[model samples]
Every structure is written in structure tokens, then in C-alpha cells.
Target: MPRVSFVHPKGESQEVEAAEGSTAMRAALLGGISGITADCGGEASCATCHVYVAEPWIERVGAPGPDEDDMLDFAECERRPSSRLSCQIKITDELDGLVLTLPESQ
Candidate 1:
């Protein structure tokens, strides 16, 4: 399992173990972490799963694809260089200690 950490805009952090192949949004929702709604499930159509990959993990996470990038334009909060849709981030051994910061709105 990979350990994913969700940091709220308020500075709160919650770490949870995510099963392999699961998306970060799924892990957050199932683990009851705040700030990730995942309204469109794990589909790439929604931007509600927006999160910012923390430093050190940014390069490892890579950049979002075309569809993800398009959907991000509709995110409830402002997009940043590190903005990403959690549904597109699949859990893997390489992401063991991935850290994400949730936006203030969603």
C-alpha cells in the first residue's frame, strides 16, 4: 500500500494507506479526508478532486494529461503550477509517501 497524505488549506494533514491501483481521490474519499469531493467518481471529467502535489513529489507525480488539464480549468479554486486532479493520480509503490495539499474550496 502507498501512504498518501492530504493537507488541508488550513494546515491540517491526514495520512492514509491507499491500496495499489487506487486513485488518490478514491483513497481520500474512502478515508474520510476533508476537501476532496470526487463528485464525478474516478472519472477525469470532474475537477472537484483538485489538489496540489507538494514539493519533492511534484516531479515524481508528473504533469496532468490533456483531458485532466482541460478539466482543471473548471476547478472551483484557482489553478496553480502544481494543480492536479486527484482522480488521475494512481497509487503505486513509487508514490509511497505522496503528499497533496487540498485547495480552500474543493
Candidate 2:
């Protein structure tokens, strides 16, 4: 299993262990992380699962795909270079200690 830490805007964070093939959004939802709404259920159609890949982990997490990038434009919070829809991030050993910061809103 790989673990991911989701940090809230105010700095509270929840760390969850995700199955290797699952998405970060799934892990967050199951772990009761508060900021990731994942309204489209992993479909790249919504931005409710938006998160900022921490600066140190940004390269490892990579950039969002074209579809995900487009969806991110509608995110409740402003998008940044680190912005990514959690549903697009697959859990893997390489991302075991990944840190994602949540926006003020969804």
C-alpha cells in the first residue's frame, strides 16, 4: 500500500493508505478526508477533488492530463501550477509519501 497525506487549507492533514491501483480521491474519501468531495466519482468531468501537489512532490505526481486540466479550471479555488484533480492521480509505490494540500473550498 502507498500512503498519501492530504493537508487542509488551515494545515490539518489526514494520511491514508491507498491501494496501489486506486486513485487518491478514493483513498481520501475512504479515509474521511474533508476537502476532497470527488463529486463526479473519479470521472474527469468535475473539479471537486482538486488538490495541490506539495512543492517537493510535484514532479513525482506529474501534471494533470488534458481532460483533468480542463476540468480544473472550474475548481472552486484558483488553480496553480501544482493544481491537480485527485481522481487523476493513481496510487503507486513512488507516491507513498505524497503530500497534497487542499484548497479553501472544494
Candidate 3:
């Protein structure tokens, strides 16, 4: 399992063990981490799982697919270079200790 750290805009941080192959959104939601809504249940249809991958972990997480990219346009927060939907990020050994920052609004 990999550990995913979520840092909220208000400075709260939650660290959870993410099972390999599980989406970051699923891990966060199951662990009770605030800020990840995952309204579409990882279907990539909703942008409520928006998050910003920390600089060091971005490359490890890779880029989003077309569907995720399109859904991001409707995220509750402003999009940025590091913006990504948590549902699109799968847990892997390479992503151990990955850090994600929650947007101010979602």
C-alpha cells in the first residue's frame, strides 16, 4: 500500500494508506479525509474530487486523460498547472507518500 497525504486549504492534513490500484479519491473518501467529494464515484463525470498534486509527486502521478481534463473545467476551484481530479490518480508504489493539496473551494 502507498500512503497519500491530503492537505486542506485550511492547513489540515490527513494521511491514509492507499491500496495499490485504488484511486486517490476512493482512498480519501474512505479514510474520511475532508475536501474530496467524489460525487460521481470515480466515473470521471464530476470534478468534485479536484486536487492539486504537490510538485514532487506530479510526475509520478502522470497526466490526466481527455475525460478527466474536460471534467476539470467545472471544478469548484480555479484550475492550475498542478490541478488534477483525484479519481483519475491511481495508487502505486511509485506514488508512496504522495501529497495532494485541496483547493480552497473543493
Candidate 4:
């Protein structure tokens, strides 16, 4: 298992353990973390699950693919170099302490 920390715009954060191989969006939703809407249900068709990978976690999570990048352009919030769709990030031991900052509107 790996752990993910979702940081809200208000500075609040929730850390939850997730099963390996599962998507970060699923973990956040099941953990009851706010700010990740995931309206497209991990299909990479919507940007509601947009999040910014913390500086340190960026490399670990890797960059979003073409489709995800396309959807990110439609996010309700401004984008950052670290922006990514949580649905595209899978939980792995290397990302055990991954920290994602939720967009204000997301």
C-alpha cells in the first residue's frame, strides 16, 4: 500500500492509505477528501479531478499524457506546471508519500 496526501486550498489536508495499482482519484474519493470531483470517473475525459503534484512529488508521479493534458486545459482552475489529472495517477510504493494540492475550484 501507498499513502497519498491531498492538500486543500484552505491549507487543510487528508492523508489516506491506498491499495497499490489503484488510481489516486479513487483513493481520494473513498477517503472522503474534498476538491477532487472526478466527474469523468477516471476516463480522462474531464478535468474535474485536476490536482497539482507537490514539487517533490512531481517526478515520482510523472507527467500527464496527451489526452490528460488535453483535458487539463479545461479545468475550472488555473493550471500549473505540476498540474495533473488525479485519475491518471496510480498508487505505487514509490509514491507512498505523494502530496497533491487540489485546485481552489476543482
- Clashing residue pairs in all predictions, respectively, total 0, 0, 0, 0
- Model 4, 16-79: lDDT tens digits are 9889999999999999988887888899898888999999988889999999988888888999
Q: Which portions of model 3 miss their true places by more than 4 Å?
A: none
- Quote the lDDT for 65 in model 1: 93
The global Cα lDDT (0 to 1) of model 4 is 0.91
Give Cα-based local distance difference scores for all models: 0.92, 0.91, 0.90, 0.91
Residues 26-63 of candidate 2: C-alpha lDDT, one tens digit per residue: 99999999978888899988899999999999999888
Best-matching candidate per lDDT: 1
Candidate 1, poorest ten consecutive residues by summed lDDT: 34-43
What's the distance in Å from true for residue 82, model 3?
0.6
Q: How do the residues 1-106 of candidate 1 rate in per-residue lDDT, one tens digit apiece?
A: 8899999898989999999998899999989997888888878887989999998999989999999999999888999999999999989999999999999996
Q: Candidate 2: global Cα-lDDT?
A: 0.91
State the RMSD for candidate 1.
Answer: 0.7
lDDT (Cα, 0-100) at 2 in candidate 3? 91
